[model samples]
Target: MLSKYPGAVFRGALSGAARRAIPASFLSLRIALPLAMAFSLGLSLAVHQEACAQTDDEQTVKAIFDERLTSGEMYYLLEDLCKNIGPRLSGSEGAERAVTWAKEVMEGYGFDRVYLQEVMVPHWERGNPEQVRIVDVEGGMIALNALAIGGSVPTAPAGITAPVVVVHSIEEVEELGREAVEGKIVFYNRAFDQTVIGTGAGYGGAVTQRFAGPSQAAKFGAVGVVIRSVASNFDDAPHTGGLSYLEDVERIPAAALGFQSADRLVEVLEVQPDARLYMHLSSKWHPDALSHNVIGEIRGSERPDEIILVGGHLDSWDVAEGAHDDGAGTVHSIGVLRTFQKLGIRPRHTIRAVLFMNEENGLRGGLKYAEAAKESGEKHLIALESDAGGFSPRGFGASVDDDVLERFRSWLPLFPQNTISYVNKGGGGADIGPLRRETGTPTIGYIPDSQRAFDYHHAPTDVFETVNRRELELGGASIATLIYLIDKYGLRDEKAQ
Candidate 1:
């Protein structure tokens, strides 16, 4: 069990000096001249003191990086987690092992406290291989690479055999109405927008179809849905992600086709407008199963009641080893705590690392954590999440008010020349988002390079070997440095004015 208390407010230290009323009367020529010179000297001393303090902060940041680069354990820990535990889908045996392993590792690191918070999560298994084939095409049957979307309902024993209706957007499905879409398998061919500079932007632009297409098509009496993989790379690797079913509508089977497969589908449809598809999916959802959010903490020297959270989801999609999807992020969170202990940096606020469960298909872990925080009245100053893949560090994305954004921007110079140089406006992470929405706590997301993330995202190719050691360690150090700054200065809203 965990104990929670009321939120704590921090007050800034005040200067003891008071102004005297005799200043105006002492304006005589001789007296005023020496007074002015003394005041100028005092101003010079103050400026010098400020400069010295900045140098000390810079030195501390440098030390954090030095410790991370030379003797970092994140990469090794990641290797063990990936090779040993493998895929940790929530409620599965792998997920249970991961929970135990994470807690044990934190305790071994000698954190002040280590514990687990109970969470009930959805358990969905991708049972057997899926099948998708073009039945009535001109050149006969053609098999397409595919993976069932998480939480999708399984097709009947005979499977679904229906004519295909192609639509680019959900709006098109609506415009077609039930007459054209009924009893047909809707094919969503919206590809990733390559023109977007940020690959993440391209993903955001195209992912809506994968997440909402199934239910939207079901609304129009569609039998099944197949969406182009929400990926940038033009390859045969099919990307899988979670999808939600509308409670009021019928749940239909949904799957993603790789870029090449999607292109082939278009070619057939152009030649034979009456082409039909045969889809078989064995994915199913089980009853809610017990899980836990693995938590570890280093108590603050002064404000132990105040908390600064660093974390990533421990559970990932079951397809691959989840190395880049979140294995790197899990180790990155642990590395932040390890850095604090190794460097002997006792922060002013408690630093807690949370390995959230069930972020891939369901957000049960995140929802539970936020609920407990609300009920217990815990005061969280900020929550930082590293869900983005472990690529070269770009910067951070912050979900905070304008004033807080400016304050974070002021510390941009503390980072290395090209690594983590900016803080843009965005949601921190799926697990931490509820905490931000419930409380006013500021949230931050570590934004690594997005160019190659989709190539390995939720595919079989995402393995431990793909992650770079230096890049992973750098991400950890970046997170630690940001945490150090937050712990020292506090957030703009919480700090003394």
Candidate 2:
């Protein structure tokens, strides 16, 4: 390393002494100069080593983050993804295009290894436009804007047109009992509570009704299930999300009515005492289709056997552009890996980027991924998932033992300038959950403060325009810094104090 400094002293060395080699004094000068040079070199090396031992290079790691963030590729790439691919529902042609595009983009980035892991995924097709109409004694019929919830079957050629029964929650249906609910449209009337400071809290309170309400109503012998729009603000758009059916109970058609339609249904139900509804859905489930989990890796230098995992689900619900739900997440994950590559800051463990499939309806992608890792005898050091929207990052939530949690907590104070203080023990992510339960590898979730997420969470308003470019970049830097620390310092083996 010191060879480069020889040029600075070369001219002075050439100028020293009048004659090139005066016999007696020249020979003595040569021997003394070489000895002095070796001794000075040894002393200089000791001082440099001590300085390095005293100073931490955390600031340098953070500098890489700052520089890359100032000029990151995530926002621009996300723009093209949303503009071209639009919506990438699991089985749709759009999703296939996204797979190709993702593969090409990563290869374009010049990854050392770029490949796809094949995984079979459920293929539920949302057919042509669905129509829903409310019948009034005077008005006769009023068509409403609505969409069939994912995984719904077609309601015959004539369609399912039944009397609408508006219920506040699954509890209401339980109270109404099978007698009242049989052969009627069960409408879940729970609304997202906008008053909550953390809008994610409001979404958490309401999403359970969307996921489980369908099966719960099926238990009571209902013909179909309809939940009120899952949005904080009023709109005509019907938000669609995942719904699961119980094993023994019959599977009924389910849909989400727009906020306005839900309100009118209540009013019409009051006047007529019995208002009928006509809903026609055209949907079907094809056989499982082939999908891929795109994986990229950066090999470690020393402890290469240990692995650090980071990912975002590639499949999104087929409505809007699927921007905030996961497009933001997908791009953010890619950005984390790209940041390291651009800075030439190589991780000490194998760093992986896994774009999971079928996360919206089924966790088949995550399940298959964990199984493959276990089968291959790969020891996952830690897994981090980012599915929550790319709002400003708050901190990480871990599904770790107490000691591991403490180690993460110790780093929280380091993030004060970024206002990230909330590292704690919690569920990692839906996709990463199975890995934690099965592999015992620690998992972490990227959590942004939950304000305004529920407003556009699953609604059509969740377009690419909703993503804040600055906030997204900040989030990418935050995760990258965490990865740097974890890779440099191994995780705690026991519970946190």
Candidate 3:
């Protein structure tokens, strides 16, 4: 075996002066043997120490899982949030209640501190269930399952009936021009590409229609806008998300048709080219309302100034319990804190858990927190977010330097293969995006298997029971482990410094 010397200089080569001083016979195996033995001994000692450290880390991670699986409260916490609080859209009574509940729960856990940061959030209400139907159809008026996109302006009090025009994308809508789309209800029919391995990518690819379809339609003088649900599965449940109305154009009513409803509409439109849709949306927008981001933390024994953050959005859509959308993530953050306290694992860096508000309609809470964090002048080691649904752990997506990302990948052996197997590049959730941008701090997103996540996302079917107890607890455990590892070690890349 080759010896690794301190200055990266090997043993075989010798200076000309030294070579002459030492006898040629003495410079042979007789002298080389002792040096080789010394190097071997030193290497063995270093290997032994490294092995011991790894074993300790492995044991700690295993304990975290065991504690969560055997006696975790994440599931029950989720139940209370979903069943008791129901929906918690920003600026709603439910959101207020959730902020209070989150603060109290963390306080009850005996955290070092529990507090709230005020933020002004957008307030939009779906005053009544949307009414969307096809007029003069073969089977009379055919009602389609739909929900108003959050922040959408209401239609006329009596509603508007106009001929329907179908378009697959924003470019397509532009191609049709005003003449083809004027006084019509524009339908954006873009489906999720199931062939994509990451379901979130599919949702990402299709969600553009929902977010911008309204303004694009309004640009063409369309009376209203409808879009195929950006969902992975075909179902009657209609998903709802926020829409943006460009200031340059008029605001128009926008809603999402359930996957099944969109399919039915498409079939009917094929047979009856001049079909018209009557859409009535009573969704109202109020002035910005007061809200807060909930925070709790455990002070570090060492490095108290450097902070490590773990969080999820506290708000959800108004249509359902909002369990999988983010209720699962909320409990996961709390559960991590509870685990550390219960296990008596005092961290090296301050660990803070934040429940961000206004993730559904706006990111006021996230932006507020990032601004506050900057004002406070605290050093943030990293921020981790779990907004993906509670499912079996897949891995983490980290937005960090390439070298730091590789360093993270090196730690994967410490995790269970099934739970957390990879750490890919380029990911930090919406709520944590501002933090990464504001401070240049590394951000991580806890990724759970999302094959079924879109099934309940923003839909009424996203309730507490849809989450599995084992899967939810396991997710918490996985997050706790990652935080522990980062705290024990650190993010200071030696090469960068």
Steric collisions counted per model: 0, 4, 0
Among all windows of ten consecutive residues in candidate 2, which has the lowest summed lDDT?
Answer: 1-10
Q: In candidate 1, where is summed lDDT lowest over 10 consecutive residues? A: 1-10
Predicted structure 2: lDDT = 0.78
Q: Candidate 1, residues 1-497: lDDT per residue as tens digits?
A: 00000011111111112124236888799788887776666555654555555666788889888887888588889888888999889989999999999999999999999999999999998888999999875547899999998889999977888999999998999999999999999999998898987888888888888899999999999999999999889889899999888889999999999899999999989989899999999887789999999999999998999999999999978888899889988988988889989988998899999999999988888888998998889999899999888888989999888877877788888798878888998659999988887776779999998888988888877889999988988888899999998888777535353
Model 3 lDDT-worst window of ten: 1-10
Winner of 1 and 2 under TM-score: 1
Superposed by TM-score, candidate 2 places the C-alpha of residue 269 at a distance from the truth, in angstroms, of 2.1
Q: Give the best candidate by TM-score.
A: 3
Q: What is the C-alpha local distance difference test score of each model? A: 0.87, 0.78, 0.88
Model 3 per-residue lDDT tens digits across residues 1-497: 11211112122223332344555566477777875566566556555655566667778999999999988588999999999999999999999999999999999989999999999999999998899998755547999999998899999999989899999998898999999999999999988999998999899999999999999988988999999999999888999999988999999999999999999999989999888898999988889999999999999998888899999999999998989889988999988889999989999889999999999999999999888878887788899999999999989999988867876777787777699999989888899899888888789999999999999999999999899999999999999998988887676532454
- Which pairs clash in the backbone of model 2? 402-495, 402-496, 403-495, 403-496
State the displacement of the C-alpha of residue 44, model 1, in Å, after optimal TM-score superposition: 5.5
Model 1 clash pairs are none
